[model samples]
Each structure stands twice: as C-alpha cells, then as structure tokens.
Target: MSTPNHKAYWKTNLRYLAILLSIWFIVSYLFGIVFVEELNTIRVGGFKLGFWFAQQGSIYVFVILIFVYIRLMNKLDKKHNLDK
Candidate 1:
C-alpha cells in the first residue's frame, strides 16, 4: 500500500462525523424539543414517541451511529490503505 494521506483521510472522516452528528442533533434536539408535541401524538408501546426519543431513542441511535462510524471508517481506512 502507498503512504496514507492524512489530509484526505481526516477530511472524509470529518465529513462523516458531521453528517452523523447532524442526524443525532436533529433527532435528540429537534424532535425532542421542537417537534415533541407533534411526535407525542404517536405512541411506541406505552411511551410517547417524543418522550421516548428524548429519553431513550437518541441514546440508542447514538450507539448505532457509533458502530456505523466504526464500520465506515474501517472501510475508508482500507480504501486509503491506512488499515496497517
């Protein structure tokens, strides 16, 4: 493999991070606060969707996003020949 390009690797990594963070912010903040009332109308089990998202959903999504980021970064690293 050729030498890994730090600038390009970090740039793509940051881009992925920004996108994931944006989604997390939207779900945890927007849906939890701004659209909570609307979302409250929908129920998941015994909990209001909004409340669930604010309390638990965001956490779950964050964990999932962490795994997704790991997988994505792994692929990216390999693509850039940085896995070594």
Candidate 2:
C-alpha cells in the first residue's frame, strides 16, 4: 500500500481501539463502580445490574467487542487492499 493509505489504515485502527476501549472502561468501571448504587436499583436475572456488570457483563461486552474488532479489521484490511 501507498504511504497515505497505510497511515489512514493505522489511524482508523487506532480510532477503533480508542472507541472500543472507552466502551469497556465505561461498562466495567463506570457502571460497575461509579454508578453501582444507581444501577443496583435495577436487576437482571435476580442479580444486581451493577454487580452483574462487574462480574459478568463487562466480560461479555469485552468478548463481543473482540468479535467486533475482528470484523472491523477484516473490513479495514479489505478497504486497504491488505486482505490478501
């Protein structure tokens, strides 16, 4: 790939990382800690929402985000003609 396309590819990758990491941080830290009390007012499967996020939800989200990142990188690779 040309230099410009190479730079754009990495830039997009970094942006994706930033956005996904931010989501993980919010779900794992904010919902699990900072907003625990408010979230605890609600429940899921008999477990407090905040506690669930702290213990399980965040892990689920992280796994989902891994798939999302893989899909995204696949598309990005195709866009940058790097899929070969």
Candidate 3:
C-alpha cells in the first residue's frame, strides 16, 4: 500500500537490535553470571533461578534469541528490499 524506504527500515532495525542486545547482555551476563547468588532464591522448575540461568537458561535464551534475531533481520531486509 505504501512505498518502502531503506533508510528508515535500516534505522529501525539498528534501534531494535541495540535494545535486544542490551537486554540479552544484562540478563544472560549480568543477572545470570554476575549476580547469580543474589538471584538464586527465585527458583523455577526445581532449578535455582540464577543458577539455572547461568547453567542452562542462558543457553536456551541465547538460542531463542538467535532465532528471533534471524527473523527480525529477515523482516528488516525484506522491508528495505535488501533480502535476497
């Protein structure tokens, strides 16, 4: 319905990427590793929260994040006519 703009699409993609990257770093690196003990009390699935995060949760989140990032980038590429 509307003409696509590459510059706008690229800018939006960069913004979203920065935000998601920040969250991923904080959650998996900071909360999961740096503050693990302080977070242990918040448990789920029989695993101490922080411990789980550091051991397995971070891995899972990273995996999901990888897929999400791929999808997001694909959409961005399509929006900007950069997809091949």
Candidate 4:
C-alpha cells in the first residue's frame, strides 16, 4: 500500500485495539472491583454477578474479545489488501 493508506490501516488497527482493551479494562477492573458490591445483588446461575465477574466472567469476556479482535483484524487486513 501507499504511505497514506498504510498510515490509515495502522490507525484503524490501533483504534480497534484501544476500544477493545478499554472494554476489557472496564469489565475486569470496574465491574469486578469498583462495582462489585452493587453487582452482588444480582445472580446468574446461583452465583453472585460481581463474584462471577471477579472470578470467571471477566476471563470469559477476555477470551471472547480475543476472538473478536482476531476477526476484526482479519477484516481490516483484507480491507487494506494485506491479507494473505
């Protein structure tokens, strides 16, 4: 790709990364800790929502995010004609 296109591609890539990471941070840190007590009032499968997030839910989200990132990057690569 040309210089401008390359720059745009990387910019989009970084933007996607930043947004996903921010979500992970919010789910893992904010929900798991800062709002734990409030979330504890809710239940999923007999587990406290907050406790689940702290112990397991965040991990699930992170793994899902990894797949999402991979998918997004693949699309981006195709868009930029960088995919093999």
Give the Cα lDDT of each candidate: 0.92, 0.95, 0.83, 0.96
Model 2 is weakest, by summed lDDT over 10 consecutive residues, at 1-10
Instruction: Residues 1-84, candidate 3: write the lDDT tens digits.
Output: 445475688678889789778878987999888999989988898788999888887788778878888999898888777888
Among the numbered candidates, top lDDT falls to: 4
lDDT of 1 at 46: 84
Q: Tell me the deviation in Å of residue 45 in model 2.
A: 1.5
Model 1: residue 45 alpha-carbon error in angstroms? 0.9
How well does model 1 score by local distance difference test? 0.92
Residues 1-84 of candidate 4: C-alpha lDDT, one tens digit per residue = 479989999899999999999999999999999999999999999999999999998999999999999999999999989999
Q: Is 1 or 2 the stronger prediction by lDDT? A: 2
Select the stronger candidate by lDDT from 1 and 3. Answer: 1
Q: Which stretches of candidate 4 lie over 4 Å from their true place?
A: none
Model 1, 1-84: lDDT tens per residue?
533487788889999999999999998999988899999999989899999989998999999999999999999989988789
Tens-digit per-residue lDDT, 1-84, candidate 2: 469888999999999999999999999999989999999999888999989998899999999999999999999999989999
Top-down lDDT ranking: 4, 2, 1, 3
Q: What does candidate 2 score on TM? A: 0.95
Q: How big is the positional error of residue 72 in model 2, measured in Å on the Cα after superposition?
A: 0.2
Once superposed on the true structure, which residue ranges of model 3 sit more than 4 Å away at CA?
1-6
lDDT of 4 at 11: 95
Query: Using Cα atoms with residue i matched to residue i, what is each candidate's TM-score against the true structure?
Result: 0.90, 0.95, 0.75, 0.96
Which RMSD does model 3 reach against the true structure? Answer: 4.2
